[model samples]
Target: MDFQTDKASLKIIRNKKLEYELPFLWIRDNCSCNDCRIQETKEKRFMLNSIPADLKPKKISINEDALNVIWPDEHETIIRFQDLELLKKSRKPEKILWTNDFIPNNYDWSDFLTDDCVAIDAFSEFIAKGAICISNSPCILNSLEDLAPRLGPIREVLFERIHNVSVDGHIYNIAHTSLEVPPHNDFASYSWPPSVQALHMLENECDGGKSMIVDGYKVLSDLKNDHPEFFKILTTFSVPFREFDEENETFANEPIIRLNSSNEIIGLRYSNQLMQMIDPSKKNLDTFYKAYHELCKRVNDKKYKSTFRLEAGNILLVSAHRVLHGREEFKPSGKRHLQDAYYELDNIENNLVLYKELRGN
Candidate 1:
């Protein structure tokens, strides 16, 4: 068999398996990047035991000279026909691509929140539109207990949601002491970017603890406009992060920000305390500091800043990568209570699909 990229499709002779033409988008959507696979506890494959066997595709097809084959599952698999003999064996493998751009414009939180849990249609609307809001209503925080059932298993919604996040030894402590959390992208340290972050405000009487959010995309765009050289250097360099535990005693490190093959901003690492300095030999410290400071300055800008007090019952859902969140220092006294959950965009989308299917919307 011959392989060529100039043609739109390729003819794949069916040996013992079925075949069909699949779109390039399908292949890109199913890319098997390391981040797409599970890496915890020495396992690389996702727990597919729950996936029904009938859901698996028995065969695939590609139009003559086609670059890829669209799978029955609506994903695509790229094929290199140079070794057609190898194609005679089992089924063709498909790759999965992870992306943050798939976040929906209209998310219905009612689908995930019930009477037992705090279901704020108003806040849900805000999340759908990717906006932020503060609330002190009684209906919000009271709904947490019902959340587990309404949202199903949390793992279903947040693919990379960590099970062991310590909340100062409390099951649901809305407010923690004034330990300044470094300004960083949520889940940036994780190999797989967090899809969505939900922070519910149960109580907030403390002062100077305003929640801050900055549009990271806009910040990067500004940097590119004003300092192309600096932008290039930052993008080229990798930053590091660490999370330590005395009881569990574990630490991890990775770049603060990452770019995909298309040069798109795909990840962000903004934890100042967790981050280690960049290698000075590869890039000058002075220049890097100037770029870093400039970016931080933009992040702190009043116009770019969206500050809100997470009053009782107000749940804030935000895109982890696009938005950077932090809190101002507050008094050590008084209690701040909230229940929080992390979810991946995939799980959220899946829930949205189920919601739509159930409501027939």
Candidate 2:
């Protein structure tokens, strides 16, 4: 195998047949040497603009650990080939779809509290599948606050960082009332929705209050596969979601389905209760409703959703961006309290990387 570069690109040839090219500017900008980047902080000291517009490599050589590039300005920089190879494998694969046959897995809270590795594993499972249950946690207020640092800092929503989930009649939110909350993602109307949501069930002293969680990605996958026209309507049209408490009014317009440039499902915003009017002038009303009803039908189907009651001291964690969560109605006979909090995906992934680095995983 041989490596070669010129003004425009670098070429790597292997077995005399296979080859790859790396752009010279990209390689120069990514210099990992101490003079280009701080060794400890990993922050850049050299900017890409510092390279001349017509700059090219003076010479290229390979050492045991790095590829050395001598630039036209006589500046020597080194970049490890391993880093480039690692990037090839870093793109995330499409998420796996879960059917109703999905069995919920619970990680023991006691084990997590004792072992850092165990805690990391639990967070990782939640990140991958979008849902996880922490069983047999200490039944106490603010139990979620203890686990907040395990992944990242908890965020405060309209209700605050840790809101009590019960029917006291003080709050007008549907979640606080003993009503059958539909399968929906929380805070769909926000311009930037919270990526992580967690619920710690402290008490389940009533009858018939079960929790439901559906994989939004799975539902979208099914719709896109089965009804392409309906999927097209859902993805292309934006709808309104509004929330108003006597003191504040929040509203945002977003499509029920979010997609990437390649038209693959990337995010979802779904909340039937909070969704407001979609004016008929925007599209064909009859057609839109037909497609909308079909999507809702699939979401509500048992074959696409997972429902189970949470026991006291059980915590349900979800990546709210991809999973729809709801609750069943219960009698107001006794206390049914839960504490919920939200976090950003950045923080969760941030700590995930930190833990892997610390554990040398």
Candidate 3:
């Protein structure tokens, strides 16, 4: 490899067609020398403010595996070429969108909780598809806590840590009623709601109430393809949402669609039932409603929903940020109880990486 440098950056040429341009400031800021970093933790010690704005390398040396740079002050910095290549790669799995006919991958509950290989497979599928169902889970009430060893800690929210949904339980929300619940993620009222949810069915002797899920990201993609304007509006327009009981209350005003720095969709905060009334006098109210209408149509379309039934020992895990879960109306004749708890997707994804490393993958 050969390299050339200018005032702002260094250009490393691996071949006639392959090359990389790295900024000089970035390299200097990331100097891995003992003086620039803590020896024990390898945490950065040199602050960017301590350096000059246009600092350049006084000398540069390239070896087969690394690049060596000498600053004006004779401080040396070494960076591995392999590390630079690794920086361009990511471990996060690409999302695999699904349609109405999609069926969630099922895993045995015992294998999922105890085996690393099975956990890795299940977690990877969950990350890709945004949902998975585990069969033969413990049927006892409050058994959702047993998932802590695999799903990390339960995220406590208003009213309860683990929620019970039943016609006979606390009627704080529509989930307790026999009426049909539209596709939505829970706790959309929170600014940053939990990203992961596990609905553990303890009893389901009801005639109907088939579980339904919509890939909110898939709907957004379709909407973006059909009406980019509507997609843009939903991402930028903040809407009010709220959920409350007799004593507890929670509320937030956030965009229905969330994006990351790269303008990639990262979340969908959609809760139709919990959405509060907005003032008619607000700016762009008419335009926002039009966009919302288009979004709503696609979200509830039968072409986007996957329907199934939850048995007594089934646990449906959902990535709340990207998937919307709901239930069809059922008769109140027979008993039907489900317990749900919240967790963060980060921990579950990290656990997958750890398991992979342990298996020498």
- The candidate that achieves the highest lDDT relative to the unseen native structure: 3
Least lDDT summed over 10 consecutive residues: which range in candidate 3? Answer: 13-22
Write down the lDDT that model 2 would get. 0.81
Greater-TM-score candidate between 1 and 2: 2
Give one digit per residue, the lDDT tens place, for model 1 in 1-361: 2222212333233553334343333334344445434655544453344334334332444444434544465544454544444556533112112122322232334533443122333234433444444343344433533444433344322222333222344331122346555445554445554555666676666666776666666667667889987777677566655444443322335544567898876555565655655566755667767777887777666666656565556666665766676666777455566555665545443554455446664
- Report the C-alpha displacement of residue 28, candidate 1, in angstroms: 18
Q: Per-prediction RMSD in angstroms? A: 12.1, 2.4, 1.3
Per-residue lDDT tens digits for candidate 3, residues 1-361, read: 8998888999887775447787898889989988999999999999999888999999998877998999999999999988988877778778999989998999999999889889999999999999999999889978888888998899889988999999997899999999999999999999999999999999999899999999999999888899999899889889999999889999999999999999889999999899999988888888899999998888899999999999999999999999999999999888899999999999999988888999999
**Model 3 regions more than 4 Å off:** none
Ranked by lDDT, the better of candidates 1 and 3 is 3
Of candidates 3 and 2, the better by lDDT: 3
* Stretches of model 2 off by over 4 angstroms after superposition: 3-7, 62-66, 91-94, 283-288
Clash count per candidate: 38, 0, 0
Across 15-128, the per-residue lDDT of candidate 2 in tens digits comes to 775445778887788777778888889998888887776678889887546678888878887877677778776432235679777655798987876787886777677667
Global lDDT of each model?
0.51, 0.81, 0.92
Identify the leading candidate in terms of TM-score. Answer: 3
- Cα TM-score of candidate 1: 0.57
Query: Residue 300 CA error for candidate 2 (Å)?
Result: 0.5
